[model samples]
Target: MSITPQSPASPAPYGAWASPISAALVAAGATPLSSLALGPDGDLYWLAGRASEAGRQTLQRRHGARTDEVTPLPLNVRTRVHEYGGGAYAVHGDTVYFSHFADNRLYCRGGDAEAAPFTAPGRQRFADFVVDAARQRLIAVREQHPDDPASHAQPANALCAVGLPGSAAAGAETVLASGHDFYSSPRLSPDGRMLAWLTWDHPRMPWQGTELWLAAVLEGGTLGTPLCIAGGPQESICQPEWAPDGRLYFVSDRSGFWNLYRHRDAGGPADAICPMEAEFGSPHWTFGNAMYGFASAQEIVCTYIDKGVSRLARLDIAGGRLAAIATPYEEIRELRVGRGRGAGFLALLGGSPTIPLELARIDLSSGELEVLAHSIADTPDLGYLSVPQSISYPSASGRTAHAFFYPPANQDMQAPEDSKPPVIVISHGGPTSMTVNTLKLATQFWTSRGFGVLDVNYGGSTGFGRAYRDALQGQWAIVDVEDCIAGAQYLVQHGMADGERLIIRGGSAGGLTTLCALTFHDVFKLGASYYGVSDLKGLDQDSHKFESHYNEYLIAPAPHADALYQARSPINHTDRLARPMIFFQGLDDKVVPPQQSESMVQALKRRGVPVAYVALEGEGHGFRKAENIIRTLEAELYFYQRMFGLPTAGAHAAVEIHNL
Candidate 1:
């Protein structure tokens, strides 16, 4: 590699600065975290995403001083129960049970035994598992799609019991409960007599409304007369768990914040243990998401997201007191307590600004934390990292919006004096999802190279509460776009960013927001959409079962959806879109199909607007392959350079912008 002398460090524009962070570095640095579990003893398990492995999720185990991969090659431990699936595996004693993504079948393996299929495969998919030792079966949520070739394929979902190998119930599926539109968290009581779960109907997302049900587990591994314990069409209930003493507990947002509530054994009313203005749970976008676990019968170790930051606490179940547990983390995604009568350790997966997503094992007696695995093996050099600053700004309709601002932070060189930084406003996908202050290399890649990034949580993001998340209800493009614009204006008004050089980018739901902001407004000069939604009606037709009717709440209801579909869809308003844009799409994406990006690109081409389209073959909703990530970042940077008329020296990473 040729080295350039720093003696000639001169003045440069905000987006045109040269830095050490490169597209290849950012692509190889990111590793997604998921599905944390606690094994016997001090062992911990988690799923680490390998972009180099073609975006496969691998099961990693940390036992004592040794950490190893539990799921080998030719086998990916993942599920497609709801398309956006999670909770793909469960472990009992030393044996591990997992659902394979390839064949959609349940497989079993352990120390001495070889990996083999345990459950018969068909059109059935399983996830969100609970290993019932007493019943010698695996309890899981199964989705059964019709086998007809030319069918609409509206599948049926149910809670099922798959027998373990070498057991009486082995390879047999006995349906315990059925007829719920969606099901999650099939928890068994400590005594193994009762079962509890969360269920929600269509048109109403889980956050909008859901019900917590409990039923008696009969002799033949079947449920009897499920009773609706809490929640309704108005309340949202999540994370149904049973403590050691047979006390049923759950998280509900009926009081505006998701807090802890427990069911009384005497058939009386369930009481709130510790009521606070904090969110004890998050949106169930994927299955098997957990935030709290019982440390013991008398205590519970939990993580709560308060104002976009996460905190860990121990709740005294009987004393009605909550005590904070200090840690180096600000975001906790999953937590699980040690099994059996001896509650020795607490296993959790969490992250912070300086820390990558890691699996930590906490000692219950001494309050000691040990990191078992790292999401990314090594952290970036401290000199090239961009620390995030949380800022709350005013938006339309007298509302407030949240964002994480990372100004250009290159330690090697500085921009010219009094030169305002060019800001790239980022919208998080999920539109329902909140952008946390995590140390993501992708964010640092821009910031370390002298581009300021504004990651907006907006109004309808989680980590605030139910009310804040529902802010996008019926507003969709309006609320999200306004919040983003408000954040950019706030920066410009504060003299922190260049008003004329503003940019916006996002993927999935955030992509829709980015598209709308450029099409309807002129606040941003350039934009990028990663598999973004361009047509509202097309989304309603192409969405999966979990989010099929999601547009009803996001935009409008059936009869009126047609009008909003025309007025709100960016594909229909392309005539107003004159700004330069770049489109990145995954051809295998089923949630938001490539047609959304393809149609928008065609419209831009017809109008003779400057545009570039990059499509990846095997990628999905979000990019995970290393090469694809590198291509996307390089192409985006190249597009922006061409749009802003910035100069690039040496062998340039080139992208051809049509009609430029």
Candidate 2:
């Protein structure tokens, strides 16, 4: 099924070009891979998203040359600790502990046996686990939801220890530390005598500020009074790990960058291990993020982001000299050190422009690579793939914004001569997150269909140090939206895209950027919002506890917040929105509820503006099921074709556009 290049005799219009990359293929090709963990027996464990099976996440194990499923069907290996869960499962020897998404109950499975619930089924969820074999217990972050489902109170998060079966207090959870708004990354010392964890308060996201706590492990699996060794309201800390030699090492932005630091003693100040402008850490949007691990007592292997790209390196702990470790990946999402026979091996989830995200184990001694799992079983040929060009463009107020520009790249199709392809500007979610140049079929689906794609890493994005990340401190919508517009305009000005057909689209926070760009300005001709925020006020009300007070940092606080929310809300100013737009919403989404998209769609319909809405049932903030992913991609493509008056492929269902 090789696709040969087409001759330049006659070309189709940009939007109407035929592509081999169908919507169905995109859904099937993009698999989610995350949370790499190395077992004591040298077995590799990770999570794989099952799109065909209702988007259930299954725990996967790689032992020797064989790969198998660890968690049985109907027992999804996930957690809802922060709603955006990670570190859902932890492995110790042959035993695995995981949180079931359905009941929020912690389940324990040993070897090939059926998984059994260990924690009492209630409104409690757990994540970021550490095994305390010496005490026959598991230390983790436990989020206790109020018993009253109708209550408006936020869930209480704390560091708790769950007794393993056969222990004196089997199935019982002992709260070790409380009074924190959120808790994560409970690490045990090599001797199991000490524990270190991270906590942060409300109104400040983990990336904005957090505290690292260290405490002595008292007898009977209890913790002594904890001491805050580093971090505060002005400093953000992440990934606090205990070195094999018993020293505490963590990432801190105290130097205006997330540099590595080591605390030799509780009473002494932490020493900077390697202070550089590069980011050795990322925003703590989810749980269990490890940027570096001890390869030995004196050497450390780490992944760092420099100028929005990731690089693998080895650091000499004593000399603080960093030496680059060559790898094919341009982005490393997760990293962990191997154990036992796998010692000196680094297990990571990594990818590059031509490679889909994959689980790989790299041998430090021999520089050998072994891929354990591929996000895409079979990726598209390189001829049809679009290699991204890392770009920096001038944005509002003479500030430079970064993005990855992907030009139309289909081997079998080409647009007419002198006709620039229509571009789709993508404002990535996480206004706090940074987008990498990893090979994503979703972006390729657009480029392969004669569309240029610009993935913007807006002002608030992580990487490039703390000051750059703080650019969106109180100017979320304004700064993010301006960056997206600037990226699109840069492409048009440089003759890379059609000036008259600029399109913008985003999801979650990025959705807010898309809506603002289309509503407040006339830069984008059309837009698409996938579970985007249309009304800032409504978003704050419907947001979960993890992000309830997030707006206090993204915008203003208290009384002044209401006015800013009203002024920035796209739904409030839809009267200025005359562009054609399509909206997608998941009925079960808790982050940005369906009302956000529905309200905007209704506004557009009433104003006689061409608009379409596609709602998916049983979906959450993001579409996970294969069918829904296919449907959304196809419907969006069809919508753009019909709006541009281009010939539709008609290979998928047509979207019903009102006021067309």
lDDT of each: 0.87, 0.90
Clashing pairs in 2: none
Candidate No. with top lDDT: 2
lDDT of 2 at 70: 91
Task: Give the poorly placed runs of model 2, Cα more than 4 Å off.
Answer: 1-10, 339-343
Per-candidate TM vs. native?
Answer: 0.97, 0.98
Overall local distance difference test of candidate 2:
0.90
What's the true lDDT of residue 461 in model 1? 95
Model 1 residue runs over 4 Å out of place are 1-10, 339-343, 649-652
Tens-place lDDT digits, model 1, residues 1-660: 112334445577777777666777766667777898877776778888888888888888888789888888878889987788899999888889999888999999988677899888699999999988988999999999899835867889999999999897788998888888998889998888999998999888988899999999998778899999998988999998988778899999999989899987677768998988999998888899889888878999899998999999889998889899988999898898885645477888888887777888887778889887767665766666778899999999999999999998766667889889889999999877888887887888788667899999998999998889989999999999999999999999999999999999999999999999999999999999999999999998888888899998998899988998899999999999999999999999989999999999999999999999999999988898999998889888888877887765224567778998
lDDT of 2 at 602: 96
Clashing pairs in 1: none
Candidate 2 lDDT over residue span 218-289, tens digit each: 886688889899999999999998887888899999999999999869377789999899999998888988
